[model samples]
Target: MAKETLLTYLDEQIEKKLADFDVAIDWDTRNHTIEVIVRLYAENTNHMAIDDREGVRSEEEIIEFEDAILLYDDQKAVFDEDDYLAVIPFAGKKGMQQKVIDALIMYLPEILVKGQDDLLDFLVSDEESIFELHFSPDYFQALQADMTTAKQERFLPYPSY
Candidate 1:
């Protein structure tokens, strides 16, 4: 199918089920193949309250917004000289990489994106099949190595819901 056809199909599908997610994808036509820029907005949960005789502010801290650049069947010049994708500005903090990947894998079944099944298989294992996603980055190898050491040396158990 032509790229335009595919793009239209995806847009319609996402629009139909827009309530499922809080993110959106924008297509870039200037490139040759099907390329898209993904963006996710950070949630704001700010509120003010009066305590005794004073006012206090409480809100969820904004860690960072989730974002990525994707290419379908094409790997053009998306990366810069520093190995960061020009389109995807935020690579996220090192500690939060796994969490971000997990979110991506958990939402892999969405029909709007291509290669859903393949990404599902790679990102998730049987036990964590429900909430795991893999990030395909040039530095993934080194990160994984460090992650393994961290997991082994400083791992702690937490109750799983």
Candidate 2:
């Protein structure tokens, strides 16, 4: 079997899982980090959106709305989070790296099956793992830098799907 970095492996896995959506990925091998951005470039369907008819919110109405929606759901990224690059750093114990890798493998398919998730949480993995998710300017600098990249790939939408 050929060995690959977590980013490389996950990139291939995500490429396959999100075949229906567009994905952009880049990695900084020097930093052992991977950055991914998922774009929902879905074509608008014929179905029109309907309003709930509950307009003009008061504090109580806002609270009720908040109660109804899950803002930080780990199963789906906040609408804005998907627009920004989600960086997953893999550097530490081999076993933990594998675990994080495993999680990433499972995550992309979950998103496809459900079409969304608590995606921002990948920025931090606590005591149970070695990965860390960071959105710092420095990381972005490295990712954007012309010299630090080890691998990058993009998957465009399927022509018919």
Candidate 3:
């Protein structure tokens, strides 16, 4: 199926680009989106008091911190012609895959850094959605602002209406 192929390709790409993180992809039927869950292996240091009579102890625990990125292909929703966020042209399977790759390359670093938080709060924060990809607008804007002319041309030269 197309979904399986996309998931497999995404997994392979993630492994190549982000070997330190573990990724799992699944279809969210209710939301009509593919949820890619990424987990980072990290150490958690905790200081705990046992009891009034007992002494305190410091414990180091290894944990996998998880966050999810959602991708949706909503062919039905209409987009304005000049919308800069409308970069992904879901014309066909191959096109979709390439666009997703571009997005992943652009955003994954920030996502990984955000995931380093203990509560994994970044996933729950409100973010802008383009082609159903949820991302922080401020972060995206900063990325755009920081890009060189060549990098901008390379990254933003997607098919436009």
Q: Determine which window of 10 residues in candidate 3 has minimal summed lDDT.
A: 47-56
State TM-scores per candidate. Answer: 0.32, 0.36, 0.46
Q: After superposition, how far is residue 53 of candidate 3 from its true place, in Å?
A: 33
Clashing residue pairs in candidate 3 (N, C-alpha, C atoms within 3 angstroms): none
In candidate 3, stretches whose alpha carbon ends up further than 4 angstroms from where it belongs are: 1-5, 28-32, 47-60, 75-97, 117-135, 141-161
Tens digit of per-residue lDDT, candidate 2, span 36-82: 55443222132222232254422221111110111121332224443
Which runs of model 1 end up more than 4 angstroms from their true locations?
1-4, 33-60, 72-161
Task: Write model 1 residue lDDT over 1-161, tens digit each, in one string.
Answer: 53323345444545664545544555444432223333332333332121211223324333122334343213432433332122222221111233222223334334224334433332333343222223445443344454443323331111121
| lDDT preference between candidates 1 and 3, better one | 3
lDDT of 3 by residue, 48-84 (tens): 2112112333233554444565555455324343322
Question: Considering TM-score, which of the candidate structures 1 and 2 is the better prediction for this target?
Answer: 2
